[model samples]
Target chain A: MSRATELVLADYIVVALYFVLVLAIGTWFGKFTKSTADFFFAGRRFHWWVLAMSCVATLVGSYSFVQYSEVGFKYGFCAMTPYTNEWFVLPLFLFGWFPLMYYHRITSVPEYFHGRFNWQVRFVVTLILLVYLQGYVAVNLLTIGRIMKGVFGMPEVYGAALMALISGIYLHAGGQTSVLATDVFQGLLLLAAGIGVFLLGIAEVGGLAEFWAALPYHHRFPFARFNTPPYLHAVGNFWNDAMTATFAFYFINQGVLMRFLSARSVREGRKAMLFVVVVLMPVAAVAVSGAGWAGRAMVERGILPEDVDAGNIFVAVTGKVCGPGFQGLVLAAVVAALMSTLDTLITAVAAIGVNDVYRPVLPGRSDQHYLTVARIVAIVSAVLGISLIPVFQHYDTIYQALSDFLSTVAPPLAVPLALAMLWPRFHARAAIIAMVLGMILMITALNYPALVTPFAHGVDPSEGYSHMRSLFGLVTSLVIAVAATYLVPAAESAADRLTWFHIPRPRPARRRARHDIWHRRFRVQVVPGTDPRLHLHPETMKELDLQQGDVVYVCDARWWLGGLRSVHAVVGEPDDTLPRDTVRLSEEAVRRGYLKPRHRVILEYEEEPIDV
Target chain B: MGPWLPYVYVYGVGGCVFLASLVAGVRAGAIDLNRPADRRTLLALVAGLLLFATVHAIWIWAASQEPPVSDQAAVALTAETRA
Candidate 1:
């Protein structure tokens, strides 16, 4: 067989193994999923590491694989410009935004809006998310399909179909558990393949210094440059674009938020987010950029043919440099990356369809009934997603198109979401207006690029105008929503669960600490007087070293509110009724702290220095 | 005629509106500052603001290193130098 044929055979074997592994995992973990929560959220029992890795896999998709490579080819090191935008958005997401969802027990992002604003807000927000997610899934499928075509000379539709089938089977069998566990497995493969290809390609291109010297200085910089070709324009005016993208991904996107929902606690969600920011994102920046850099270097050196499409650079470089087996791993990695995201989108779409739409329409359905509907919805979503392959395929670069699409649709929803969570006074009517007005303004902006030229630069009259729309809409939405809120009547009890103050927090159970003054259990006696003050015997006070007036915690030995104690005043009263090693408890103190007379309570007193 | 003028005009009005809404929300009890989570979120907001300023400052400096020229201008300059 020829070299190309050999690589194809290797890809087949590797892809086959990948499918089997995914299936085996689904079969193994499928038994554990017993309810809608288990299927949709992995029963909220996922550890930080599982959630972290799964989240990483979801964020770094096949689109990133191809797009980062494409950017690296054109802009050299400046490809990281987009990745660095996440850093600015991370602190808020980790500390503020994600914790709200965790504390609110929100299964979906729109549910928060429902509780905060109204059903209309929830419905509108869900529509926006579903549209964006569908577009997102289509863009990813198109990119992965293109990769399969470029590398193995297969048809794009075949690649799309194969992925749709494999992802659907596993997701249908095991739901979120399968998606998450496989994501961990696939996430590892992604890092290895991404870094591996970069290393091999770097060696092929001579060295790192040689690669830098080959590219222009501007190409190496991460800041804005408007003068480059429309494709290579490293437009650094990222304030609005960054804000929109970062907020939408972490806060608005259900697929991403679902990963956080799977985490055990808000603390775990925070840690998982930190893992993405600190560990995965930095390495991914280098790995994805390396392939394109190598592509640029090799083309300049005449090692490979020039004039390859920018999007094809990643696959082209890896195919030429890596061995057949390594090529298979890269192919599997790309497929894994694609499936990881696809499964999440499919699951999220189904969840929104059932929970927000179907289940709500028909209340009191069995968990199994919803589960069946969820599976059916997943299949329908995948089919619908595959049908959109051609729509994204027409774009010059999938990344630019995806960015523009997200910018247009996501900002309208993100504005209301951010406001609803942070500013509780955000009116439901205002949210409705913002969603409508923002969409109108953004879509209108897209239609009329001439309106934006005075404000921005190099933006084509036809495309790349979404950023301008986002900036305009985000500001306008907040303003309009705030204004409308004042005009409207205030909600009687919106803050009970909607705002930060009203959300329930788990109070720590009281632990019993050693009463150092008396390590052993001292006898407790009831005082005859109804003074309600806990009196200690003068001899007992001397042994326990009680002062004239000191505060001590009287804890009921048995369960009182599951180990709650009450504070009481200690008086050193030499009582004849109270015997040695006996402390007197007033009936009132016993009733107040839920203690019984002679209930063997521990008298905890702060230490006072002995009289020297 | 400066490019920065439009940015300032648009963002300035937008910022004012956002601030107004925030104040209104607080007064209406829509925004509860007393909640622990809300207070923590305020701290995050402060940190995010600092981060945004710092990142943009760095980007502005880097952008200044190379003059703001169009892709056409750069291409024309390359052709001119070759001639």
Candidate 2:
């Protein structure tokens, strides 16, 4: 192993400052996390731009920087394959799955399983998903540890432990709210730091022209050779990364689901998804892979030793191009990548643990009790992640370990979930059989290896047939699902508001009104009742266009919160006894909208089209 | 393999996946072909794929035209080659 590169005092100071800034942001957001909704979904109030940034930060994990850089050095532009090819999965995600999950208010993937199929399906899916998420956390922790070993000479396990502690502390305090807020800051920092390193490296290699000219011609192509090499090839990546892995991330990953659910509306969520795939993802592709490309250019120009380890290329390149303090900034970006992804994963595991595992066994618990358990589960998740670091260390490259894990784990779940959402005929029994049989086939492929050869598509299988495993699993599961659905009687009823075809359409408003027009502020009062009614004084109702049974939106006066503190209620009989400027809301509406008692709120008629 | 092979492979394979999904959606009545909104979505999907293919083709063409170190020469200089 190569000796770690030591840093100067300036570097240490910069890193320390970054850590302090992250913790401070987490603390600030912790104040807003008051309920399970706040902890898991951030009160569903964030704008598309903020969520887009956070999603990019979460997507570009520490493993992305290191592994993509290593591949960028080895194969050049093909490092972008994973990020660029996600568009193929866009149709299913945007049209089919997004609406179903948003309108149904599905909290977790397993929750959807329970709603769509049966408890048995939910139980099976919950176990598989927990394993997938915990394994993801392990991969990320191991990657950051590798970076620490390269830069500071610290042992890998210690580095991972320290990161987990930092992330766990803030996650325990604020949950999803803290994760979203800190990720925005970390996102900007990592992007700026990555681009800065790239530009500086170009200057070091004489100029952009010289750098371009130094690279080998074959490396300039955007795709690798068709299928010659077992590890890095166009065909294998198209199947593994683009087809299977992309589906897993966008469709099934709990962290990504939570990010979408945190959006204020389905439209905002769609905007965030579009921005992530179209705009931010390509930029992130460059940000994560640029260092490796620069490192290769340096090697060609004889600026660095030719035999430098590919795994250490990112650190070596950053050290070569950046000055003392700036190197620390770039290092902090790596840490930022790790922490952003890690915190999201931790929160997701907590959601699944509480919602699927803990809540079912002990139902009807108080909200406070569930909230406390969620925090405890977050801490336990961090500890469990750190413990798995050793298991992932056996792979030659971090990229290999992650790809193997994703390809193996994603298909079984992805196949069933896609069918459950799209195919109305698919029932509970088919789903259960598919998952069980799929997992068994995956395990068989793992031990036998030759079973995957039929699906290899001419790619060599010597490198453990990592990518082909996804194809085998998906095909096997799909076949099983189809056969069982046909063979077994369609006993289960069609899931209402659960499948794609049955998503509730927005009814047209009774009367036309100006869009987003807000009325005067009124003091809010929570009337003692279970009725879904918002009672306003006669004069107040008249001013806001008086109509009984009309839907109205009541929101906090502070518009900057982006409807986080908001609720929708039906207008009731005008209350002549109440004060003219006060609105009376049911206790449930007040709680659902997170409205503060006695606080002034603005009311609007709900006549505009619903944009779901 | 030629430089254009990756593009062909990607679009050929990716196009199948995309089309298959659309068919499934239509069969399930999840995506109605008669609706204007759904039709627009289909058009956008086709356009997006074409846009990626066009941009990648142009990028590779531009990069191919540049005078760079040949693969043979670069491999000769390096002490070890991964591929």
Provide interface RMSD per model, one decimal. Answer: 6.8, 2.4
Docking class of 1: incorrect
Q: Model 1 over residues A1-612: C-alpha lDDT tens digits? A: 113424757667886787789768765666556568767877554557778777767878667778889888876766765565565445446544665666666778777777776777788877877877777777767766776686567888777877788788877777887788888888888888889988787788788777655555455555445523444343323535456777887887787888787764555566667666556776777766778878888887777787877877876888778886777787778778788888888888988888888876898988889988888888888888889887667765765665666777676777767667666567677778877877777777777766556545555544455445556666666677677778866544354356543434433221232234336455666655556566766766666556565545565555322222233445545675676666677665554444555556666552211010
For model 1 chain A, give the 10-residue run with minimal summed lDDT.
A506-515
Off by over 4 Å in 2: A1-4, A145-158, A387-405, A489-497, A509-612, B23-47, B66-83
Model 2 lDDT tens row, A177-227: 899989989999888888888888889999989988878887888888788
Cα error of candidate 1 at position A119, Å = 1.7
TM-score of 1: 0.71
